[model samples]
Target: MEEDTDFRIRFSSLCFITDHVGFHGTIKSSPSDFVVIEIDEQGQLVNKASDEPIYKVNKMLPEPNNLAKKTKLDRQNLSFEERSNQELSTLAGCSDGDQIHAPGSEKEDTIKDGTSEGEEGNIDVLGSLLDEKTDELLSQFACDVKERWDSKTELIGPSPEFSLGRILDKNQRTILHSAIRQKFPFLVTIGKNSEIVVKPNLEYKELCHLVSEEEAFEFFKYLDAKKENSKFTFKPDVNKDHRKAIHHFINKKFGNLVETKSFPEPNYSADNPSVVITVRFREKAHKHRKRSLLECQERKVIYTAFTLRKENLEMFEAVGFLAIKLGVIPSDFSYAGLKDKKAITYQTMVVRKVTPERLKNIEKEIEKKRMNVFNIRSVDDSLRLGQLKGNHFDIVIRNLKNQINDSANLRERILEAVENVKNKGFVNYYGPQRFGMGRKVHTDQIGLALLKSEMVKAVKLFLTPEDLDDPVNRAKKYFLQTEDAKGTLSLMPEFKVRERALLESLHRFGMTEEGCIQAWFSFPHSMRIFYVHAYSSKIWNEAVSYRLVTYGSEVVEGDLVCLDEDIDDEHLPSSKVHLVTEEEESANTYAIRQVVLPVLGYNIQYPKNKVGKWYQEVLNRDGLQTCRFKIPTLKLNIPGCYRKILKHPCNLSYQLIEDHDIDVMKEGSYIDEATLSLLISFDLDASCYATVCLREIMKHDF
Candidate 1:
């Protein structure tokens, strides 16, 4: 039980088996007994086999070549006793039955007496042996990832069942959990209070190792602290459950509005619905533009709304590409908010000083890229940031697995959930989409870098390709990793023309830190600002979640609550952050109907209460200050804004489609063994997310 000084075992300890594809078979002996091979620059083993590298971390391995092999050969020529003491070293995982023989040695590859190489005459027998469970445990550890070619040959084939083996970071335990859910979907119910099946006979050492504890007592203590019990056959979800209470409160508060209404039979699943979104403006009376070819357009600012379906293009990127085709800079076009790149988005955008004819040409170019399924109509005024009322969402959630119960009960449960949302609004937490989607670099990291004035790091993070499968972009990132700016620029593809421009700036301005900051300006101002705003959104969401957990559903005396519905923006309430006076507190008029939270900024005056204190703690945890939001050097400081701590969709409605055609679904598509699906449609004020509402229903299931 003493601390194992085995380097290989220590390396394995740093990895998780459920996260990767290691040696698939069971192994009982220490990894030190196996011949470890070094990997070459090409990510291949330096051996006669010339196999691909498997381990992700083995920095201690010698450089890939025949030098280590020659050294081993030289040692082997010594007496049998000398050869037995010096075993060959190579980098590979070995199961119990697997064999690792020296390239030229005539001896059999077996572990006798716990020693790797045995004496020529007789090997001593050691009582230390690996059990079947321990062997299985050794195989699951994610000590290494194989190269693409090797994975196809040595492990699971390409496109392996659920993309389960790929582990991105050590903090990520969810991938393994996700794989378990995918395999046992029926046993898992996702949401706050989600549950999963637990195997009762798991080994004590396995559990201890998984929990990163050395002692069985400590491991059981950790499990007990988490309230895990062996008698409990299923793991229950422990998240907050306020839906029923909220529904009850809404019935009492808004009695008549809680009436049941019949809904039309939906044609799509709420998950994989064909979305039809239209951006609504703050100004209802805003006039549409007419053709004015006779005179130069007086309105230099042009606002346009366009609908795009499954275009797989970012709103700004598409518009910016169109602008380039029209011989204009990307910055010429501006939008209030970015829309989903993979959905049918009808969004509004602004372009400065463009004729209606020119706008049509730009639209035509965009249409060509979007498979000609789009509509771009120019309006009179430019769309200002935060100028939209809200977006109207027509979303379909697909593959409704609700047929286990009677149809009536399923329908009732869905209707009840929808009704609760319509009346009691759920927590207005920022959806995960607020953060970058599928990007290697997180939005918060870039924002923190900028706040800390690490301009070069921020620039590299933004430009570097995250997904290594993308060979072209991967090559571009490789240059950045090697600090070869010129090479990166030369290899940068046309799709990354913007990144190439930034790289060119780096090459021209010199590779100094200041040069990198100047080059960062090459990216669109909107995109750069979005990174900073992402941090703000994260802070706001965290604060709201903290407030909900701390104060529960009721408002305390010092809480910042919403005043009235007269405020157009439900999220950004017109009511100020007010401290509840004794009179208002006693009257219960200022009770927590809705809370307002701050997005960190220089101008944002955080509430002088517990909520404000949480905000400060969040900032302090990251070594950031509110005052740092004003980055004068970069001229990119953002004044803070307030966001609602809770939001309810206006005119909430939904239709559950029973036995809907599984084939009709194209977006958010999922395989539905169940014939039924759901179609949910709702409207929310600008800056609110429909997905947040859906999260209230689906929870972690989404």
Candidate 2:
């Protein structure tokens, strides 16, 4: 393959690890072709279901209410007859013993005018029909009904049923039925021969059979018991919708205290399977069992950690989708590092104040977006950037372009290249992703302008468009030509978040230098840091290239190297790096791979050699000095650190195959007999670019 001049000058990837003959192949033909899995600090691989002992919890708990206390007090104070009259009048939607009257309509007032002569005669007859024993019995029944309603304990049993025994007179029975209907709207009355039977209505019966909020807490307590028999099983006979409602109710009310599992009962049909819900205390809940329910709620878990596996989606896009579905902002989530947008990547993500169940609930939704989440568990803290040991890659390169006809010869060449990378490593240049692609101006240009305090230039560079055809570019053009923020925003696409945000701010704050600066600063901290970080990365890449070209991968005097004790597997802080002395270089204490380069910052130390001098020269060319990194107005400071100049792919291996090997060919398609594919797998340290390693093996730019 020929060299790419743009790649060399732009990205500063000037050299390769080996001059071995290589083959050409296409990458990312499909999302699955490039797989990346994160390795955590504990050296454990993060994959689907790889993490153990998942700690599950409900999304939220039922909020506490004082209804029970208020009901109890009211019941104690009011007599049965008076409470019944009040309740009946309430059910009838009228004042006690008064007919519902239309406002502003003239009618005979029962209370103000006193009872009419005809009403008095009917009242007299009804009073004569009633007896003291019957009235006493009815009042006792009302008391029982009130007690049962207040307790709310008979959730899984039969409905509250009572029999009005053997009424001999039909007028008395008819009057009794009317009274029962008025007093207890929740109950239904039936005439069984000479007897009257009263039971709760079907709707009320269904509600009673389902779990209540108070009963959920009781079930939680029962499961939380330390005894051997701590468990609760709910076997309700209901249709599919009712069963689903029961499940949702239990999950919402129980919270994190209990775990519920449902199974289809034996001899049940698929259309409407009888669900048996088994509830037990989660293993972690036992520690908080002694605490009160309020205390437990107050001490609910803080963070939920899970594996997020996404295909062909950028980190921000994936997080944004999740935030919308999970009812949270994107900032609520944190991951160790961003993965490739065109790969099937798996990494650990931690979310604040989220339950494992909430994360699990979105699995179907995320899966529809070609992503998935699993191995959900509660954690005490969030994952920070650079928290992982490394990343594992499984890459397949297809449609190889090579002159070799023999498969054996191609395999031998691929093995040689793989061995070269494993032994000598490759130049550690930041990938193209660090620098925004296909833009009219590079991100580093904006960063340099900011460092030099050229606010207007930086704003112009940010708003300028690469082309006028696209919607976002047209918006940018409109804004630049007319300074019409609203009109520009009208032309802008919603997905161009940063562009739209700047336009929105300009619309409100006016299109002035001060307004632009304020709008720029209003961006999220991560986004604000991104441009400057890209500038630092560009400087580091150039420095690494210069170091390799001049010294040829040898440890030189005045080069900075991290002490063994202070060297971190994940990151190298500036404080740990030490300048190589003449004696240290003479003794050859540090290898070429151990040398580090600074990513220009105010607090970092420069090399004591010519390479260090080159760093200042590069910054000077951009009208930037290291001290300018400290922006007091923005409350921004870059305390950058050292990075290794070389990285070797660990456990590297490769295989060569043809299209027919995987049995993915179409019946009528033609096969390229001359072209073969390469499959490689390896692990890279955190912050290391796998594409750079591949560049060494293939001698091709990504």
**Backbone clashes under 3 angstroms, per model:** 25, 0
**Residue 565 local lDDT, model 1:** 43
Flag regions of model 2 displaced more than 4 Å: 1-8, 50-301, 403-409, 663-673
Give candidate 1's error at residue 309 in angstroms: 6.5
The digit string of per-residue lDDT tens for model 1 on 205-323 reads 22332222233333222221222121111111121122222222222221121111112224435543432211111111224466474322332334443333324565656764665
In candidate 2, position 371 carries an lDDT of: 89
User: How does each model score on lDDT?
Assistant: 0.45, 0.64
Judged by lDDT, which candidate is best?
Answer: 2
Q: What does candidate 2's lDDT look like per residue over 292-320, in tens digits?
A: 87778656646788888999887777776
Model 2 vs. true fold: TM: 0.61
